[model samples]
Target chain A: MTRTFKIFAKELRDYFVSPIAYIVICIFLLITGWFFFSTFFIYNQANLRTFFTLLPVVFSFVIPAVTMRLFAEELHSGSYEMLLTLPVKLSDVVVGKFLAGAAFASLMLVPTLSYAVSISFIGDLDWGPVAGGYLGAVLLGAAYSAVGVFASSLTRNQIVAFITGMVICFSLTLFDKIAIFFPAAIVGVFTQIAAGYHFENISKGILDTRDVLYFFSVIFVFLYGAHLVMQEKR
Target chain B: MIHVEKLTKFYGSFCAVDQIDLDVSRGEITGLLGPNGAGKTTTLRMLTGYLAPTSGTIRINDLSIDDDALAVKKLIGYLPESAPLYHNMLVYDYLDYVAGIRGMQSRRKAERIHELADLCGLSGIMHKTVGELSKGLKQRVGLAHAMMEDPQILILDEPTSGLDPNQIVEIRDIIRRIGREKTVILSTHILSEAEAACDRIVIIDKGRIAADGSTESLKQGSGGEHTIHLSLLGADFEEASRAIGAIDGVSRVERVEGANVDELRLRIFAGGPDRLREKIYACVKATDWIMVELTQEGKSLEKIFRDLTREV
Candidate 1:
């Protein structure tokens, strides 16, 4: 467990030392800030519904960029050989890199909290859904981060990892929105598999057990998939 | 102590390492010498537990690599070829990270990092990023990384491949100092490196061990055939060959090429070692030809290596 944290700390430090982390964060804040404020006056709404709704779409692309280099860089540089030969388990490496990606994705959301605070001063902002929205955002980011790590493990090219991760995240976010094309009888299954549907339930302040369980399941399935892919490398 | 039995690895249909059995006792520097694609790197990877073998087993200090891989990893420190490290990390940060992963206490970790920096001549470059350093500096940093825990066994794959002569000598001195108390195994294609630094040399050809011995023993054991070169003025090849070929111990006589028109150069391949040089000198003294050069050359390590690994 301690070794896992060591890898996690090292990986996170690796991210901050490069310009990529700052650039990604600035772009994320720019896109989200522009989209949410573009329509805040028309709705005259006190709640942050527009901001929370666009979170999944904005994260679909941003989270993959953050996680793409976690495994791909190590493999391409041949540092994976040096890393694995250490006195640490493969699980430690998998979990460590996953946490680093998830943590960085979570950190990107910290700056967006000013949006909620600014809106609170202008109008009556209900704190319940605001709290739930932030919770659901974190869970969603973690799930996408897991998918991105799994994609990164499949190849040594960072660009390929990013594209593959973006494709998977885009499909998960678009599943419920595209369910109208499916037959009526199986529409429920598509909705259940979609990440946006559960995130919507949490952002509405419903706090359903099923929604939380869905996010946890996504995190587990993708992390386990990443673990399997890494094991096959040996 | 390390023992390996029938260690074989196959990449699809091609075998990279074939049924290699080896043993290394304590405080021994064993050099794995081979040509390119002779499975030296593959063997080192398997020994370090980075790659699982296709067949066979490895035992280090009575612990099986298959059953106790983490335990074995704790005992061995491995430096892969070219020293692939995090390019963005500073030298101090990289060594610190390795020490953290190796389970060194924070206080001791700082102390050990400084010690290794001094030992590997890395104290001056501790603030520099790894990517900006020269190849020799990066290799020294890698040595410090591998020696962070003072492991019982050290494995290096082509440790001095891309360094200048001075850097190569410095690294060799470091390795020799470490080999005094630990078990050291290094692989190299440079024949002189193996002869200079190793206590035992194991030559591999086409995924198999062709010869294993000390440098002197290998030179003496490989046929013991020495050559005598004779450069004569005012003597033709025919005359020199007739005079030197009649000696009892001389096996064959051939004229060396590219001599002056009036000079005759003859090479005599002699064996059996019955004072053949004195007899040749006496015959030269008796003849009217002026002997310009007469020298005997012993079998060299390069000759033995070529004889063993030459393609059929």
Candidate 2:
């Protein structure tokens, strides 16, 4: 466990020391802020429904950009051999990198909280759903972060990893919308597998065990996929 | 102590390391010498637990790598070719990160880093990012990283490759210094490097152990094929080749290329005993040719290496 933390600390420090973390956060905030305020007065509903609605789409792109270099850079640099030859296990490497990506993805949500604080001052804002929205955002970020890490492990090119991660996350976000094209029997299955659907449930102050379980399962499946990819590399 | 038995590796259908057995005792600097693409790196990779062997077992201090990989890894420090490190990390941070991963305490990590900085001459570049440093300096940082935990075994693949002469000497000095108490295994194609730094040389070729012995023993074991260089002032290549080729136990006589145009040089491949030189001198004395130089060349490691690795 300590070994895993050491790798986590090193990866996190790498994110901060390089310009990648800052650049990714800047782009994430700009897109989220622009989309949220542009539609804010149009609704004038005292709630952050527009921001929550666009969060998954924005995160689908932003989280992959944040996690693209996790495994790809190491593999490209040949530092992966050095890292693996050390007294560390494959689980330690996978989990440590996953946590670092998850942590950075969640950190991207910190600046958006001002949207909630500012909304409360202007109108009578219900803090319940706003707080729940933040919780759902974190879970959604982590789930996508896992997907990003897995994608990064599959290739040595960072651009390829980014595109692959984005494609997977984008499909998950758009699954429910595409469910309308399918038959009624499978439409329910598509909706159940859609990440945006579960994220919407948590954002609306409905803390369903099923929704939380869905996000956890996504995180688990992708993280385990990353572990399997790394194992195949060995 | 390290023991390897019938270790082999196959990348797809191509075998990189064949079934080879080796045993390394403590406090011995063993040099894995071979020509390029001779499976030296693949063997080192398997021994360091970077690549899983197809069919064999590795035991270090009674711990099998398959059963206790982390435990075996803790005892070994490996430096891959060219020292591929994180190019964006500062020297200090990289060392500290390595020390942290090695499970050193905070205070001890600081002390060890300081010691390695001075030992590897890295104090001047502690603040510099690794990518900005030159190859020699980067290699020094790699040395410090490999020695971060002071493991019992050090496996270096082409440690001094692509360095200037002075940097090669410096790195070899550090390697020799560390080899006094620890088991050091370094691979190189340069024979002089193995001759200088290693107590035992294991020559590998075609994924097999071609020869294994000390430097002197390897030279002695190489078949006695010595060359005698003869420079004559009044002689021609044809006459020298005919006269020397007729002698018993003289395998071949060839003209030697010489910078001095005034003298004709001939090299006699004497496969006979040590007294072949006297017989050659007698034959030259019988003639009126002036012998400017007549010297026998000693058996070199390069010759033995070529003889072993050359294809039939």
Candidate 3:
């Protein structure tokens, strides 16, 4: 666990020191803020539903950019050997990088708190949905981060990782929408596997165990996949 | 001590390292001398547990690479070929991070970092970012990082490769200092470095150990023939050659013109370390020739190395 913490701290330091983290944060905040302010008066909604509604699409692109260089750059630069030769497990590296990306993406959502606060001046704001919306945003970002990190580990090219991650996130986000085009017999499972399937429920101020479990499950699967790739490299 | 038996590594069907057996005693500087693609790096990687072998057993002290890989790794400080490093961080920050992860206490970590910084000649660049440093400086930082934990065994793959002569000497001096206290194994293709720095040399060719011995023993065993060079002012080339070649134990006599037009240089190759010089002197004295030079030279290690690793 201590070794994992050291890796985690190193990755977190890496994010702040590199320009990629700053660029991702600025782009996410600027676009999310512009969209929220542009549509706040038009929608007349006091809560963060509009922001939460736009988050899935935004993260599908932004999170990939953030996580693209996580493992790919290391592999490409031959620093993967240094990382593996350390007295640490493969899962330590995966989890540490996973958390670093997830934590960075989740922090990008924190600036939207002002949107919730500004809405309090205009109309009656429901605290439950706002809190639930932020929780849902973080969980969703963590899951996407895991997927992006796993995609990065599959290849040693940053561009390839970015494209692959965006593709996976896009398909996951809209899998439910595509289910309507498919036969009704398999629609149930297809709908269940969608990216936004459980997000809506969690964004509606409902703390359901199944929705929480789904996000965690997705996060673990991709993080474990990255770990398996690292282990195979040895 | 490290004992390796039947060590092999295969990349799919292609064998990178064939079956090899070796022993490294405690506190001895062993040089793995080989050309490129001779599996020196592969062998070192396997020894450090960075690359798993296809079929092998490496016993370092009481730990085996099979069940106690992490323990074996903990006992080793390995600098891979080219010294891969994180170029983003400052030297101090990088070493600090490594020390923390190596489980060094705060006070001891600082002291150890200071010690390595001085030993590796990195004190002046401790605050500089690794990306901004030169290649030689980067290699020094890599050495310091590998030594951060003070492991008992240090496995370095081509540590002095791609360095200038002065940098190579500095690195060699540091390795020599460290070798006194720690068991060191450094790989190099440079024959002089192995000859100058190592206590024992293990020559590897085409993934196999061609020879392993001290410099003196190797020279004596494989390069024992004595060759004497003679320069005479008046002796003719054919006459000198026939006279020296007819002597006992004198097998080959090579003649060339000396620096002077009238002088003839005869290289007398003889078996065993015998009194060929006395016989050559007597022959030159018998004739009215002026003996300008008489020198006996032993077979150089370079010649022996070529002969041993030569194609069969």
Candidate with the greatest DockQ versus the true structure:
1
Q: For model 2, how does the per-residue alpha-carbon lDDT over B1-312 read when each residue is reduced to its tens digit?
A: 999999988888988888999999999999999999999999998888888888999999999998999999999999999999999889999999898888899999999999999999999999999999999999999999888899999999999999999999999999999999999999999999999999999999999999999998998778678888889988888887898888888999888788988799988898857788888899999999999899988789999999899999
Ranking by TM-score: 3, 1, 2
Please state the CAPRI-style docking class of candidate 2: medium
| TM-score of decoy 2 | 0.92
Candidate 2, DockQ score (0 to 1): 0.73
Better of 2 and 3 by DockQ: 2
How does each model score on lDDT? 0.93, 0.92, 0.86
Error of 3 at A192 (Å): 2.0
Candidate 1 chain A weakest ten by summed lDDT? A225-234
Q: Candidate 3 residues B1-312, lDDT tens each?
A: 999999888888878788889999999999998777888888998887777889979899968876887677678888877777888999999999888877789999999999999999999999999999987888889889889899899888888889888999999999999999999999998899999999999998888888898888887777467788888887788787887788888889997655778878888888875777887788778889899889987677678778877778
DockQ of each: 0.81, 0.73, 0.63
TM-score of each candidate structure, all chains considered together:
0.93, 0.92, 0.94
| Residue B298 Cα positional deviation in candidate 3, in Å, after optimal superposition | 4.1
Give the runs in model 3 whose Cα sits over 4 Å from its true position. Answer: B223-226, B231-239, B256-264, B272-298, B308-312
lDDT tens readout by residue for model 3, A1-234: 877888888888898998877888899989988897798788777778878888898999999998999899998887777666666667778888888889888888877788888889889999998888888889999999999999999999999999999999988888887888999999988888887877888899998999899999999899988888876766
**Residue lDDT tens for model 2, A72-107:** 999998899888888999889989999999899888
